[model samples]
Target: MYLTKAKDYLLLCKTIFSFLAGNSSNLISQREMERFMYLICLIFLSDADTTEDVTVVYGIEGKPISINCSYNLKENQWREKSWCKHISETKCQHVVSARRFWMPFLKRRNGTTAIADNIYEGILTVTINPLKKKDAGLYQCKTDFLGVVNTLQKVKVNVLTDLWETEAPEEPRVEQSISSTPSDTETKLHIIVAGLLGFKFLIAVLILIIARSLKNRTTEDGYRRENEHQLFPVTGNGYYS
Candidate 1:
């Protein structure tokens, strides 16, 4: 519920992961480096339904879940906007069971849910006060697109029973990846920096070798000229006829 009210944990982690990659891309000197960074990013992103374009969210079982989502339901997509309760940080837990569709109007089964919340009567009083607040704007624009005259009423309903758990128990992979990313990124950065420094050192050594070779050649030529001058000297004291 906290995660739902604030921000999705999985999405927040993915945002940070992408931000790191986008900003740090300038330092990537190799294909292997970019691949490795994206692989780390995938660890944070792949667990969700990106392949199928499905979004996983979180909320409570009843009392209008505090969330309204547009997604495919029952494989038929009869209901595009699913009234979901985000029980877990990243998983939509309960789904309302509506056997009928395209009715002129819907009956409130458990406040926000038109149907599906049933069987549990114990939580009724506990949820009565917030029920109005939760289901306030649900049907505000119902007539806007449904092409039908419908109005969201403030008629109070019973508390919702913990209905069908739509999503399976998924391991929190995002938590694992987020907790360990800092150390992994730092270590990889160190390795890349060291490789870059070693390359610079190699270039410096080549330049020194070339400079020394040129200096030695100039010194040898000067020595040879001095030896030639000493070996064949013209006698200043003797005159040539």
Candidate 2:
């Protein structure tokens, strides 16, 4: 009972508000109402991620343009309390959905850079460079209310030419080359020669040391044996005398 009455009251309020939005010559003063209007535009753009369908037809070289929008619902079709509370972060879905279109809009201007005053008076405006090829796409303005939804209008942007597009080069063709260059072969040969020389030098030194050691051992053994024989005279019976 209470829920039904509250729904009735909201529907009445929306109808009255829609009239004011369209017919009232005075600008809305209340911050809440203005915010509500902003939310209405957001709902329309909830599905738009970019400004591709929305075109900036007029603007000064540096000044930004604005895109404004409004929407309404039927009295019988009003939903109960499903507005801002259900939406996250000041109704981010609308902004999130609008991103795809917004990206090209920025790139057309300066690529991922935020433009000042891109939104105004229910109208979203942006500055464009008109020279970027990626700027060319479709744009649309949409409006909706609880029960009534509308795709209000759209604009198309066309880029005549861009430096990026014009200056692009053809893909290169690289052929694998095989070569036995003199410098590289010479380096390898020199390394091999040096290694062989080092090995020969090491072998020569080892051989000399081993031979000298064996010769000294042999000479010492011979002298020791001779000294033994001299100290003890060997008789014919094999006894030392």
Candidate 3:
């Protein structure tokens, strides 16, 4: 039984060591390797504590922002959790803690910052309200487990001063419909007016021609009667004189 227990313990330690070695080998950045080593030591040794730096986060100025930190506890029991601002590579300023008093500088708040933790899910969230340009900096979330302080994650927040603006396209103007040809009703009315004027002109010309013909016939008849009277003298009683 003693041999079996010893073998199991050795196996567990081997697994952990292999995992740490594999992770360290995969890291390309020297800073990342250093952070990995720090975390490994914090986990293996009681007196050592370290923070693992994470990805950078971006936020627009005057906006609310939330940063998430996730970690695996690996069966270790955590007694406390904290959120801090990175002062330097090897130092941090504690802002809030799960089981401790808030830092003196953070005691008075304008409802601008908060932190929450989920022990079961191993997630820590830091929130900032109305984020300003001054809030752009490095931050860390840490946990105290097995009498050792270990960094869950670190983040660099960058607050942008310029907010994106989208201009809506101008609405297209509606053009009034134009027609080159007249409507059916107007065209018909115009044709009728032209026909009426042409009929009136034709009637006037016919009337003038008939009147001239009648005047010429009347003059000829009078001249013939005068010639007959000059050619033969007619008695006053209806005979030629």
Candidate with top lDDT is 3
lDDT of 2: 0.42
lDDT against the true structure, each candidate: 0.40, 0.42, 0.63
Question: In model 2, which range of ten residues has the least summed lDDT?
Answer: 77-86
Which pairs of residues collide in candidate 3?
Answer: 233-240, 233-241, 234-240, 234-241, 235-240, 235-241
Residue 204 of model 2 has an lDDT of: 100
Worst 10 residues of 3 by lDDT: 42-51
Clashes of each: 4, 31, 6
Candidate 2 local lDDT, 65-131, one digit each (tens): 3333222334212211111011332231221112222332232223422222122222333334333
Could you tell me which 10 consecutive residues in candidate 1 have the lowest summed lDDT?
117-126
Stretches of candidate 3 off by over 4 Å are 1-53, 73-77, 99-111, 145-147, 165-241
After superposition, candidate 1 runs with Cα above 4 Å error: 1-182, 234-241
Residue 153 miss distance in model 2 (angstroms): 42
Error of 2 at 236 (Å): 3.7
TM-score of each: 0.30, 0.25, 0.40
Model 1: number of clashes?
Answer: 4
